[model samples]
Target: MTSTSTAPGAAAGPDAPRPAHRETLRTHHGDTVTDPFEWLRDKEDPQVIAHLEAENAYADARTAHLAGLREELVQEFVGHTQETDLSVPVRRGDWWYITRTTAGDDYPAFTRVAESPELPRGAGGVPAIEPGELLPGEQMLLDAQAAAKDAEFFSLGGLAPSPEHDLLAHAVDLAGDERFTIVVTDLTTGTVIDESVTGTGYGLAFSADQQWIFYARVDDAWRQHQIWRHRIGGDPSADELVLEEPDERFTVWFERSRDGKALVLQSSSTTTAEAWILDLADPTAAPRPAGGRRDGVDYTVEWAGDRLLVVHNDGVEGFALAEAPLDAADSSAWTPLLSAGEGERLLGVESFAGCVALELRAGGLAAVRVIPRRADGSLDVEAAWDVDHGGELDVVELDTNPAWDSPALRYQLTSLLTPATVAQVDVASGERTVLRLTPVPGYDPELYREQRLWATAEDGTAVPISLVARKDVPVDGTAPGYLYGYGSYEVSIDPSFVPTRLSLLDRGLVVAIAHVRGGGEMGRDWYEQGKILAKKNSFFDFVAAAAHLVDQGLVAPDRLSAEGRSAGGLLMGAVANLAPERFRAIIAGVPFVDALTTILDPSLPLTVGEWEEWGNPLESEEVYRYMKEYTPYANVRPVEYPAIFASTSLNDTRVFFVEPAKWVARLRETVTSDQAERPILFRCEMVAGHGGRSGRYRKWEQRADELAWLLDQLGATARV
Candidate 1:
């Protein structure tokens, strides 16, 4: 899609539907290049679905003049959301569950409620799910707006229930790809006992004697390689498989062990892992492994009490906490317990039957600690603590404890102007509580104000960012910022709260988040100096956090704006080709902008397991010239960039949608900008995936049509 001079949302005029180039050469190591929009990567090309429906009808006739500022940013994201809410229920043993949400249901119903000795257990044994009656024996599990009323892209994936909760299972999907479809039901004869599993891939468990069910399938490069089992009235062609992961770089699944007595199973990759276990009181046994695979060793197990915690990075690289012995067999008999500290990073390890939470990441946010359990039940890791969460750039975490003999714990906190809460500490007298806070309606965390700034990069390194705004705006230099980013797997983009970002902080804009260098925020050596050949230090720490927010005048060197998604949309296409005049609009979502033609094609779908996070440029030539030096569709040049947009989806499956449809057809044939005042747009989505259109008011009308075109390119559309 690259030649145009008109025919896109054509009212027969203002041009821009360029789709004609068909060059395609792609050699490698000895460098052969020439890829003119690689035939828009043929999605069964009917002229590549008519050039992605004529670039979504030229991005709906160029934002059809921002449809009333995208319906006032979807009614200011439904007037700061809280529409008939519910959540905080949790329990999971004698039932409790909850989920609710009804005001204009785009999905959310899943009820439960049964542990009755007639109510009363509030604060931590958590019973009070009040509002509008029905508690006595409640029930109705799964309405998901009546299973997404005949799906047009629902998603759920794994729900699972049956530990005598009388069966349920769930799964579904409906074509936002990640294949699903399990079903099962029978919660006390509501019937449908097993839709015979179908494809499957987002985890599910149910075996502690409900007779089998496991799941996790994928492959054909959609990875999650095998696992299976089935049987509860089975015959999805007599299921069974149980573990296949023949290393196309790992990726398996499993779950069930917060004392449901063993399931774990894992596998993983992007730098090694392995874990198995199974047992569930022998529901046809056979999972076993707990350790073995090694490479750069990574671990994961859980079950605490009679041991088996794990969490590893084998001889430590910012992860540690061992334990083993539940019929041990690996890491040469584990043991340690916590160790790995210096600049922290831990990340996960839950356990409960009184305590053992963890989850860490230091110097750069996220906390949640706990330890308790030592009257002889074990894990007093030097009596651990930290759960305060009284903001130090708040993030907190460790949520839904699912009753592993509930000594409470729960967690969650938040930041970027609070509104998230969900407390409940007490891992033996820490005594917190809160339980539910998220109601935002007209949010006013004292009219916002968050900070933690920093920046530096180009090898000097520093980074950080975060920001948030509207504490009476005025960050001199005329505000209007926006920022956001993602860096890459070492994930960590924390600070939560989003009632549609209070419609970009009540419109004065600002916002922020960089935390760059392949983010796990300052931890595993800040993700080993930003990955493979120091992946251009995540585009020079996102163009040095946009030149330290426009040289500290705090944004507005032309109203800023930026964003990311999917590997932070490959760090927003390498900072829009490394600083395309410091943005005035960017976006990128589901991007991964043709990273060296999808990592030099190892037959695509997750390109050879993302060669441990983008490196094996098909047998290195210094990883194919270090991924063709910042592969944003081979570094599009002709400058003058900004105002881009890009979005993708048409069933994404991990950054596909032809890499933002050949990077908006090679920036509409190599940028030099001014295509009628900086327009690049391209959108796509048509029946979504890679997180786009999937109910919840179609994801708030696709985030109010991408924040009404990023509040009309950060001039901040209307509302004060």
Candidate 2:
């Protein structure tokens, strides 16, 4: 965009491609906001599309020299990874389903084997699994490579099999848009049943009879407001609407009950929740609400035999476990089974034939409690893991507990330095078995180390930080480091090994994660303290983390880089405005930098739904003022910024591409001219959305480009 700011050392780059600008004014609550780059909002406009193409050309010219390095990074990552890999099989109904990714295929192949004898214990007290090959009578369920053959961008959504195992209803997203088309097939005959049903959400379930499908239908705002029932062989236009949520902020989705006897419609917003149950035996009846909606309280329901297991945060700040008769007439009948302790947060509960499992988090760690009876009876269970600092991860989660009659619960454990390990535990005996360990061909865990560190926030609050590095990288303030953070939506960024990260570790660089207030790592309280009016705690905590690393002599002032995606990108932009000199470079992927403007507009996709997480500024003048004070685009000034790279997807329905497009435009117009060599690069994927390109190989190349760019800025050469 063509705009001028003539403060000391502030002007556009000599070769920067400037997009044409048109003046636009927006007013909210008597406040005037000017946006010159608003013309770039419409992707369909020829001029708007040309500007993005020009921006891409400029970015290509700048990073063209790193082409060789990008290829090398891609090769190094591929070498470390097990090209031909098989996922740990899960028992479902009468078969054990598995997915495999070959060396050159863009997608995985889903297959299943006939029910066999129970796996016997091996030498190491683990279930025996043939890691490389399938057993006899293996049948192909769905080949993703074949499904994606016709589309430039293909993403698989729901893949649900009928209770009788004769029909499969799978969802496919051919465009980067989140909406999917579900195709029903007769598994026995291996043929498509009829025309595909389009505009369906990811959550789709089949009736036990295998004649109908229940799915969530997304509205124009990308919200799942209606749940529909579609007949497999009938016209999708004749699909019945089972429920329509009146509250726009709340979304509705359906899932078949454990016994496949009913369909559950779960609806929730940022702070409240409600559930409805539909009897599958009588498809003509409407679903009835489980209980009256309670404000500021959230809960979920699961059926075990004739009892309804409920996990709610009604009376307890964290959460508590309760139960009711399947046909309970009143909410008061919810019998409190267990209450969380001072620091424990009862996350959720999973029901099975023999036992019920509880997922809990405390002191920034995660664990799962397996109760043999109908309930655990108490909040505390003896099935806790003692975390090992050097070798093991602190988080142990309940993973793949699919069968209603399973005798064992499958869980996973991982850390910053360790690859994921899938384990199984007997419900009755509580004896744990290690099932599989993902193989990374050329990497050694012993050569690297990971640790949890704490940093003090301004209010004396301690923030958790996860760090990993090569043993040779000394804390002498000479090595380069990359710090990452995402503290919104109560979404915890836990530690999981990434093979691509080896390129940084072997190159003598340190990687760290700042577990700040907005994340659910600690508990509900931690998340509460970081959102709404307390949202700034996230950005401040991140700054404190960077300062803590420097004070600990782990990285130099000029060698430290930063990264954040989505809301974390909002954090990156805010901190950059608040303290620009603290970081040397930053990469924000699909960032939400235009926070204040987005929140004030109610018609946008997620604005109204997100008002609970981020308060509505349009109705409150105080909130509008506060949001204005910290909003990144609103606070752009003439200053020397860190080397910046912002990425966006044209079809990203979550955070619109216009946000980052406007942000990079403003930065190029306002930032110091002396920093011209420090590129403020912007890259937009013309045919992708929030998750980016679909294929694994495409994703790897994209990652290589990003890592190479950051590595070049850090002055750290890749050793491999």
Candidate 1 on 1-720: residue-level lDDT in tens? Answer: 011122211222246678887798867667888877788878887988898888888888887867776877787788788778888888788778888887888888888878777886676667876654557778888898887787788888878788888888888888888798888888888888777777778888888888788888887768888888888776778777878888787788878887788887888896788887878888676788878887988778786758888878876678888887898868899988777567888878888777788888777888877778777888778889888756768888888787778767788888888878898877778878887888887777887788888889877878988888877877688888888888777888877777788777777788888888777887877877788888789888878888898888887888888888888888888878888888878888888888877777777786888888878877889978887888787787887888787888888888788888888777877888766656787788767799888878889988888877777766677655
Q: Give residue 610's error in model 2 in angstroms.
A: 0.9
* Global Cα RMSD, each model: 24.8, 4.5
**TM-score against native, each model:** 0.31, 0.94
CA lDDT scores, all candidates in order: 0.80, 0.81
> Positional deviation of 391 in candidate 1, in angstroms?
14
Local accuracy of candidate 2 as per-residue lDDT tens digits, 1-720: 111122211223437667767988988888887788888878889988888888888778777767787888888888987888887777788777888888888899888876666554452333345645765678888999988886779998888888888888788888888889888878899899954589887798876666778888888888889988888888888999999987888988777777778787788897888887788877657887675588877888776657777888887878888888777633686888777777778888877787778888866777777666634433233443322223434677888877888778888887787688887887767777777878888888899999888999999999989899999898999888999999998888887787888888887788999998888888889999998889989989999999899899988888888999999999999988987888888999999999987888788887889888888897888788888888888887799888888998889999998898899889988988355557888898988879888898888998887887788777775572
Q: In model 2, where do residues sit more than 4 Å from their true spots?
A: 1-14, 117-134, 374-392
Best by TM-score: 2
Give the C-alpha lDDT of model 1: 0.80
Pairs with backbone N, CA or C atoms under 3 Å apart (clashes), candidate 2: none
